[model samples]
Target: MLKKTLLAAGTAAALSFAGAAQADIIDLFTTDQNALILTDVGGPIFSQVSGANILGGFRDIGLQVFSDTGSPAARAIVEVSGGVFTFSNDNGIGGQATIQWDGGTDALDPGVLNTTGLGGVDLLAASADRFILDVLTADLGFPFQLRATDMLGGDFTISLTSAGPGTFEIPFAAFVGVDFSQIGSLSAVINTAGDTLALDLSVASIVTNQVPEPAVLSLLGLGLLGFGITSLRKTKTA
Candidate 1:
């Protein structure tokens, strides 16, 4: 009887382990005005990037000015107006902004999802399997780059060209050898010559996959312990 109980527990645990795969959805934009803004030590959602360092700034990120409230809450919609890039801080100088998705080390924070510890390869593979971007605009400029950076400072960039704008599935497979475990942030940068470029772009949604919690491991361990206890009882009875 005890042996049977042990075998049943082991089988149940194995089934649980197999079913551990799950999906986590993160919304970049919401109708809630009080939504938690993505930020890091650099600043709020928008910041100025110079020489690998992000500085605090409002308009520097170029996102605050281009937002579409008319869009549905299912995704964030942004439209870029005309902006000139200047070197003297008079206009804007090749703007780039980073939005941190995994809230760093703050357990109590609302944005905390605790994904930095996941294995890089696992994260990237999972994301690649389930990643989608819905773009609602017709023009997103020419030669814009979308970048994802890991905690180890490894960056994978994808150069995007305007295809008359529609739902775009991000080529997560392009991020080969990236440390997905520490996927710290996502950024967008526009490359233009002569420090002046006309801008028109819009993004509707960004959806990606993430690993499930480690709770299943604990449950498996418990199941194993129970199985061991049952086996010991069977040995004593015999």
Candidate 2:
């Protein structure tokens, strides 16, 4: 009777934990699966690049760079390729994006989702516990904001302090008035801050993190306890 009870408990725990683990992660985007490349040319008043990520329902990945002086003859190059977003000012000689300057030079990379991409529109945000972004930057020139918006126009913005490299995890509760079931997009903006002549930003991946509920945790613990008792009983009997 003792052996049977222990075996049953362990089996039940394992099954429960396995089921919860299946829903623990949802991939948003990864370069190994999709790639977006963009670049700017000299003498263009407005230069931009945009494309689909081809993963999680073909979400859009785009970037835009323009002259601060509104000149059709300025030379500044900004590009994103091989997962790295590079902004170069040509050693301060070129009129590159001065993010906070009145000249209006800046960069915008709007990572817009397909809404109905990740498992459908209803479950996209509802199923996700939090959003995660994996990035590496070389002291970003200015403060940047990661903004998320829902289909209903409700939005939330997360500020990212200047850092070299790190992972950002945003909880769903942080968003105000945003409908989780109707998530629309995520965008990054660096519009109102001092600019650095040269900057490199690399994005590794983006994903969601989901954790098992309390009941699942309890089940896991019970399973471990049962296994320990069973082992002890067998050793003593032998």
Candidate 3:
């Protein structure tokens, strides 16, 4: 009797765990995925970059990065690395963006320069940063638009990795529609990049520290205990 009961219970627990995976929204990635859309450029986001050591900053800038096309929530990974000739931010690392982009002398795009204030920004060839995104099929429908305001004010360079199909590159990119622009009532100018970013979602991902929900975990544990009992009963009966 105990053996029979344990077998049944064990089977039940294994099935329960399997059901949990199916019940999930079929999502992947981390909460940091939103970082894929760079925004709110400012002193708070970065300090300053020097050829030798990264300098501190005294300002804040606001900004945002997004893809003009495709669905939001899709699985994707962003890779940002900086050094001497790579993507660098915040004093050539992951501290600050590299410029100012509002208007005038400190205007953004190609005219950006190092200043004492936060405005627009970009990463350099010596820094690295990353963000990952993953949304299931249910996350699709309307376009995926995430915004990050220029809280500080400086330029930043980010490498966006995506799961959507695109050009010849991995994760695709030909018709990826990477339209990076400033948001405003009258549509601001978008500075085109001079470098090629390498973000292959097929091989990159981020690790997060978020813990699984306790209730869910407890349920999972209970399911296993039930299954084990069921199995033991089955063995004893045999």
Candidate 4:
């Protein structure tokens, strides 16, 4: 009887530990405009554009004019429609543009992307996590480079091919080295080679495994020790 009790307790404890270490997936795009922090242009406003499901039936759009000499002064807009986001120059201006998603001050610190607002728990700082983006190109032959920069000044470049009308899942593993305690902002930039280079992006996220607390680990160890002691007592009696 004691052996059976110990076996059941051990099994339950192991299962609990496994459950505590599960991975979490966070959605990067949403109807909440506060979730995004944009710079280098006018209002990064949200509206119902003539596109498909960008997110919850609407998309965020913004326009900016660069006067950095020899560049077109037309208002270039970054718009999302039907889950697809496109960046193009309205006045045939060809230059560089940037878009960023800020987790918000309530969820993340200024210039920090830590796990504070992530369910009030801490995550493993050095886990092999992935930052995923669903993206494609408007021109099937135009190739462009997208750069992702983190708060700690870490830049990872992803070269996109134009063999795409269908959205492809691009997973960036460079986020594994990020400081989870002070995770900052996530931004993407593209330098247009011509007057127009339309790249569509959707569904950005970060997936990572959770870390168990020290108190939880102590409880697990105690449970195992109790089980072992009970099993030894049963063996002596038998």
Query: All candidates' TM-scores?
Result: 0.41, 0.48, 0.17, 0.39
The whole-model lDDT of each prediction reads 0.32, 0.37, 0.20, 0.33
Q: Candidate 3 or 4, higher TM-score? A: 4
Worst 10 residues of 4 by lDDT: 1-10
Highest-lDDT candidate: 2
After TM-score superposition, what is the CA distance of residue 160 in candidate 3 from its true location, in Å? 20
lDDT-superior candidate, 1 or 2: 2
Which lDDT tens digits does candidate 4 get at residues 22-86? Answer: 44333334333322223323432333222221211222233333322222334444544343345
Local accuracy of candidate 2 as per-residue lDDT tens digits, 1-238: 0010101101111222222222222222322222222233332223333234422333333333432332333324444456544343322222232111011112242232332223323334335555555554443333445555555555566544343345544455545555657655444444223243323344444555454477854655554343211110001110
* Cα lDDT tens digits for candidate 3, 76-166: 2222222111111221111112222222222332223333222333321112111122211111011111112222221222222122221
Clashes of each: 2, 0, 89, 9
Model 1 agreement with the true structure over 1-238: per-residue lDDT tens digits: 0000101101122212222243333233321122222111112233222111111111123222122222122122122222212111112222222233333232234233233322232344554333444444332233445555565656566554444434333434445544545565554444322122223333434556442245743554454442211110001110
Superposed Cα deviation of residue 66, candidate 1 (Å): 16
Q: Rank the candidates by TM-score, best first.
A: 2, 1, 4, 3
